[model samples]
Target: MVEPGPTTPTSPATPTDPATPTNPTNPTPAPVASPVATNGKLQVVGNQIQNQNGVAVQLKGMSLFWSQWGGAFYNASVVNSLADNWKVTVVRAAMGVEEGGYLTNPAAEKARVKTVVDAAIAKGIYVIIDWHDHNATQHTAQAKAFFTEMAQLYKNTPNVIFEIFNEPDYESWNEVRAYAVEIIGAIRGVGAPNLVVVGTPTWSQGVDAAASNPITQYPNVAYTLHFYAGTHGQWLRDRADAALSKGIALFVTEFGTCDASGNGNLKLDETGRWIDFMNSRKLSWANWSLHDKPETASALVPGASTTGNWPDSALTPSGAFIKQKLLQ
Candidate 1:
């Protein structure tokens, strides 16, 4: 997660003009809204996101992979379980990536995103529409189109957040920043005021890189870094601390309990320490998944009994963690 802080202005940079048409072939005029001040800060009802004094708001939550491409096994019960049982205040939804074979068709993909977004809104929880796999080659146009539509649809909804790109592994920070800036401009053009989340390099595990560049010029923009304990635990913690020291806001949008050395599958002991650190800092976080069926492909799913059946005792250790730490 990136830490929250003050935004500094960039050097006389002009925000991309919203009225300028990008696609003449699609002659539909872009959505419009009243002009608001652009001071590079997150605003709600014309006010910036302020810290609640020194008290840290516990933002424990989970992510949902509800689209068919991502193995659309999540049902309505899953959503209700998280909100009602886990008391999750946030939900990360993969916005149907283009490569996820299930969403190769654009129309179906849009419908899938709407399904998850609508469910999250009904629960009165903050939902993040993640542009998964935005780092894949030649996805700029797809990302722009997807974000533009989403911004136009949910611009006025404060509970909605936009993650412009999932994890940009191959691109340099400069390249990623340019792409993010372009997408942010497009969303702003659509009159959306939702907080936009930008990813750092190295699969969004580079919080130091994010801090060095800083998204101070974009209002309501938060630098996002994912942490997989199996790969980058210490670095994640150090980068998070550094971002906080710089007064920048961060969200631990993704993490798992695997060992940092990748020796085995899951390691709860190491993850517990990370969780404690996040809680101490008062940082916001979301677990990777909430799927309930072990027969399904998701790691978060509960296990099954004999005869290939999902038994009542199928909950994963991580799921139990959510029940204990986040739920109650």
Candidate 2:
């Protein structure tokens, strides 16, 4: 997530109360089933994301903001709301690793991330555990350990996707590739068959670079390509086409309707084109965020309930647009 100004830290919202019967006389209904029950495990098959049965599948969902900042929505109620109301099939847990994040408070950060992850599992939707760091290469050891632990814990579950790197700032494709190899090895080393996503160079825009030299060792490995419609246009799509032509899979792990700065005008026209492109190519994606920050990318108003019973009034224009897309 890119920020144009300093962020005002918000207190973490408490988790929503567990399901309760509306009336004392009636019993609560069983939770609605989620997409995972049907899709099962996911795999990357030559530029496409396929379900365990080898059929192409596209997952539409929202991404939680950096764990340290957007920790309010990291709970079952939020996930349940998205699954039950917005009809999202997946959600990304962006665990911030630096700047007073996991590096400073590992337990708290991990707990927040796990809250979303476990919620997604209980709701039966896929969840991406993203290492939301810009300088991931420098903390290879920490990342490896973190992912290794996650893999061991969730290896048998098919609802997890490990995003080794969120976005690489100035690193070259080769440098990112080397770091990814180690992380990918750690996940696969633990016998986890879940798909792993690696970020590209220049903040995940260099899909063509990754295509030229893709990871050949991993079977379910996919590359990430992030864009803000206002700042990135057809040129990035063209670059993505080049990567797809090379038989490398791509996943738009994070994107916004505004500019790259995460604040600015909403470019619905360009976002439409991206939707068409992604739909045509059957690309799986998670919107940039589900936070209540004061930005164009934020889905809700500042005072909106963090426990996830948001009405139309609570949603921003961007949130409404994304919610409509997911529903479609």
Candidate 3:
């Protein structure tokens, strides 16, 4: 989880201008094929994410910045651009859980997430309802309530995926795994079989540790493996390989082309290597962010249109690189 500082912008005392869904007049080109329409419900079959037919699948997409600060991009127009222009198969709504987020103003924060989820569903793409909290173990009650409601609402929808925890900072795998069992129980208890992604310890880099002791009660569950190309190198990939050897499914829910600070010089070489690794392994992923904040991770330039139809001038170096990969 990003702290309220230079790397992660702080939110206002309260959200006075939350975003609502709107159909812009000049939208991007329409997407021809729907990933969800083709793949149907995704399942974990032997360390891989597969469609309903048991064929392996890889989903590449963008993750919206924290809902509290980057709420402008939570509308349907952004989702349309990602699906149509960016060629993304999935989108992640990282709803901030602290600061002036869900804990303080549940109604406003949740509305932003619902807008994204509903938009992704309408566009026939997969959506990850991420609980963007670092200290999720302390907020177990709130997390359970939020996911329980989400499961109940989208129980039958195959386009939804629940990320119970974004990144666990200092929590051990045992602590994180226990918290996941309860939240996964909450989601499964509602009869929602949508894929559930759980974060690992040490800012989601402890796949090796999670592999040592994995969750057994859940079906269609996978562990998150987050990385920033600049900070995490082959060492992390080796750890992931070891985890994969243990027969646990892995997903790159959040990644950056720059350092972990969310602002720094672009590491294109490392980013390329990471991309090649994910592609070779068929590991599904979502880019770190889709906002225009002044950071290496933010994809768009400042003052870029909140609506779709972004031209080349509107993209940052990181944005252009990520778009190029998604288009491929």
Candidate 4:
């Protein structure tokens, strides 16, 4: 749904060369190490994500909205502000891969991603390099190439988690699983030990289906479950519970405090219930975005500055509410 129209089917493009004036986007180099190393590298064990010391880790963070449209906010200063003030420890970079995105302008998209990734590296916080595609099954070749480059570029950085597919629409679990295995193999082939999270069917709400049969035999692999509290309710929770009962690790990479449409009123009641569930399970989660889009889910108001450190008046109702919760 992120893409208004379907992109033409095409193979994966070549990975960007890390060394060049046109180097891919990345964070600046700051001497201070963030939670990423201070706590330790993250790994998967059973249904939980473990820190370097093998302690269970739960990250409360924000996800930058679709990269193509929200690229303006993926800067080092924004990341620094979020980490230093917002109490966020993990950031997901939602790289747009379709519609006039990666396929149409690979260089621009890659640079945008590198900008965020490099900033995250400098900040020393964990980051998710998300292939923000709904029709990822149709772009397997491109995914392989992109992830390969990502793995090799940050093989030494365990903070990099690869989300090969954002939301898989209409694609069956069988199809999604196959694509994930292939992509996971590509990342592993590059000798990158970072974690890889695969999206489930039905816009990543089909966690139970993925749990029934998952992509095992790969280390640090997990599944994605997204929700918009105003729309997704008990039915979604039951599915997530089923996946957990089956020992499947789950990460809520993209979620909104509003309706699934990314607009309308905020559902505080349902949102609280979802938050309680995630808290009880110690599951990591990231809010929908850092964009200033004119919507209830958009945390910032129109005309808000692109740089981090916004005034309280610039926050929307949902932003104010979520920030309070994050501060807790």
Candidate 5:
């Protein structure tokens, strides 16, 4: 996970307009039209995430940094700007639940998530309401309650996706699955049929474990596999490849081109390989972050405004890289 500290802005940003969100040389790339209809919702079908029409769909977009710390990017204007300027198909609302976040202020954190979700829905894009926690199993009741509320609120909307956990550092697949089993049941019990992504052990790098013993209790469940290009190489890809061959539904809910620390030179070569792997699988993915934190993965520079519209100078190399990818 990208550490939230290192730089914390002390003041709340008064929201700004959604204008040019990048440098002029970048020319605020034109937003492309999507073929996917506004009414269609993503569905899980036999190792693939397909559109409502049953065609395999690949979503490319960005994930906000932890909500508790990076709340500045959790606004509708920012979501709209990305959809318009970058032409992304989905966005992940990474709601942090620990370290003075949801546990300390549940209502506020939930509001942060809802802001992005509401924006996605209004803009006709898929949104992942991620429970951004490392030890989600430890807070089973909290996870259940948060998901249940979200499921009920967006029950009929196909645009909403649920991620019960973010990263599990050292849990067994059996243990992670046990936590997922209950949380998945809770979301389904609320009559929400949208796709739910469950995190695998070891920071979601244990897809092979989930593949060996799949979650059979639910229908629209997919295993999450997160990777950072500098840290995870072919060994990780081989694991994911093996799992895919076994017919496990996998989703790249979060990933970065930099190292695990979220700061490192962009390993262009390695990141390219990971992109190729995901493209081959036609996987849906959201980049690690949209924050202006001083990290290689942040995509923006420190002191960048909270508004979604950023200038070229504000964009980091990773931000420029992601904007180009979203265009594809």
Candidate 6:
């Protein structure tokens, strides 16, 4: 059972300046776009990612799962602290299930996503918008529509990367590949060339699956795999070898204290091995979570109950390891 973290506060709506004109002819102009590259294929150089330039860049980021279930990480100070102070480069957001187990309510969900995305962007960090679910039953036409809309909206913005789906276990590779193809095709149809990250079968924890079928054919596509010492170790190594041999880019997007079996949590040895592998490969990664929860648990927030406030010092040894490795 996953534990809950501190209830993130609600953000007050940004009230428009009342003194500003209300009519179009006498209206205030929209904010100017930041000079950063906001569109086109994500630039990659050698093994490192970059913007338009050829600079070697690494993504040091955090994952925000608090937005799940309609909640918000309303603390801008926390966001700024992580991005500006902690030097996080990206923020992975998980869009949770709404009513009837569907990822519906696109407008509301997108707005929620934008809150975090905009926060990261304001801090000059990249943002990854993840459709966090593994249930194939949830991947309906409406979900595709939502993604397509997102693609169009961020088509011109390079700072945003759209993760087509989260961990997708219980489905065969053929099924996942087909779903990916369809979803990717739809997103591309909208003329958006942002980097698209796709997950493998078996909860996206299967590195072997990703290594077996390299997704190099898709433009700006990066294969993503999650890891937890309890569930994946040697398999991850094998997959990493496969990725290296195939010359395909891989991202170890999510991992944490758990072992390969997902039994007990916080296996330091296994975590070290995985970290070593990623470091050797110079791969990009995002830790499983940042919120305070438990030591052996996946959430970073400490003392996080199944339903309660998260602890302040939840950054475990593993989280610290991740921070050291990625927060370069």
User: For candidate 3, lDDT tens digit of each residue in 190-293?
Assistant: 88899999999999999998888989998999999999987899999999999999999999999999989888868989999999999999999999889888
> Candidate 1, which ten residues in sequence have the lowest lDDT sum?
3-12
| Count of clashes, each model | 17, 0, 0, 10, 6, 26
Q: Local distance difference test, per candidate?
A: 0.59, 0.86, 0.87, 0.81, 0.82, 0.59
Ranking by TM-score: 2, 3, 5, 4, 6, 1
Worst 10 residues of 6 by lDDT: 12-21
Clashes counted in candidate 6 amount to: 26
Task: Residues 50-155, candidate 5: write the lDDT tens digits.
Answer: 8767788888889988887787788888888888888888899888888978998897788788778777766778789999999898999999998998888877
Which candidate achieves the best lDDT against the true structure?
Answer: 3
Q: Model 4 TM-score?
A: 0.91
* Candidate that would win on TM-score: 2
Off by more than 4 A, model 1: 1-58, 69-71, 101-103, 134-137, 259-263, 292-312
What TM-score would each prediction reach against the true structure?
Answer: 0.75, 0.93, 0.92, 0.91, 0.91, 0.76
| Candidate 5 lDDT trough over 10 residues, lowest sum | 22-31
Clashing pairs in 5: 21-310, 22-310, 22-311, 22-312, 23-311, 23-312
- List per-candidate RMSD values in Å: 11.7, 5.0, 4.5, 4.9, 6.2, 6.2
- lDDT per residue for candidate 6 within 1-328, as digits (tens), equals 1223333333222212111112312322222442233322355443345456554445656676535432334234455666644566667876654432235455555566766665555555667878776664356566588779777766765667887777776877667777777788888898878778777777775546665665544576776778777666786678667665665566666666575432365677887787777767666667766654333544444433322233335556655666666555
How far in Å is the alpha carbon of 74 misplaced in model 6?
5.6
Q: Which candidate model has the greater TM-score, 2 or 5? A: 2
lDDT of 2: 0.86
